[model samples]
Target: MEAGEDIRWLPRHTVPDDLVFPFGGKDWWLIDDRLLAMGHTEAGRVTGHEIIDAPKGSHEAVALRNALWPLAIPHGEYRP
Candidate 1:
């Protein structure tokens, strides 16, 4: 992207009952498939990052990332 963002995606809309942001509505990144760096947010702003070790729950995080990948729309194609 012109903004230097490698990839931008708009998540597909889904029913509220479905799992979304299962990690306490916080933003997160699965680092090298080994650690989960979850950001704690307040008013849409990140306040801190908490790292989750792989053995603790990285597997579930991986699965969630995999499941959501196909549902994400590239920034260039999203409508809303």
Candidate 2:
């Protein structure tokens, strides 16, 4: 599916300069502020994916969402 159609996209500039790209470390998916699906990395490559049952409104989830919010631009407004 297309990004704007199935999922939102953010421009690279929206990301914080100090934050390492997930592709450079570990990758994760936070869904609905609840589920956390993380991707394991080995030798800079994704090795596997795991899902964690994170609850919505949890401190960790909320903190993560807040940290990411400032770095995200609306999908419709993102350039490049």
Candidate 3:
């Protein structure tokens, strides 16, 4: 997904055991085949957008956020 794109992860209590793809600059939601909330992330503030559901107790819930943390800001900010 490009910068400033909003997204929602399906399934409020379970983690989807697979890779997710939130492509394009358009906002999208990542839902499992059963249409449940997992996790979500956006480039900017999600005004008026509510993160309905997410993994209740799994580390994978932060997978996308952890991965995207590097891209949150510009280079040299987190450099050693």
CA lDDT scores, all candidates in order: 0.71, 0.62, 0.40
- Candidate 3, poorest ten consecutive residues by summed lDDT: 31-40
Predicted model with the maximum TM-score? 1
TM-score to true structure, per model: 0.64, 0.54, 0.25
Looking at candidate 2, the ten consecutive residues that score lowest on lDDT are: 1-10
TM-score between model 1 and native: 0.64
How far residue 25's Cα lies from its native spot in candidate 1, in Å, is 1.9
Please identify which of the two predictions, 2 or 3, would achieve the higher TM-score against the true structure.
Answer: 2
Backbone clashes, each candidate: 0, 0, 7
Tens digits of per-residue lDDT for model 2, 1-80: 26344344545566667865433345566666677777898887888888878464244655755777766666667667
Write the residue-wise lDDT of candidate 1 on 3-71 in tens digits: 565353634355235675667766677776779998888887789999888565788777877777776
lDDT of 3 by residue, 27-67 (tens): 43334422333233456655443343444422343555556
Ranking by lDDT: 1, 2, 3
Q: Is candidate 1 or 2 superior in TM-score?
A: 1
Off by over 4 Å in 1: 1-8, 12-17, 74-80
Better of 1 and 3 by TM-score: 1
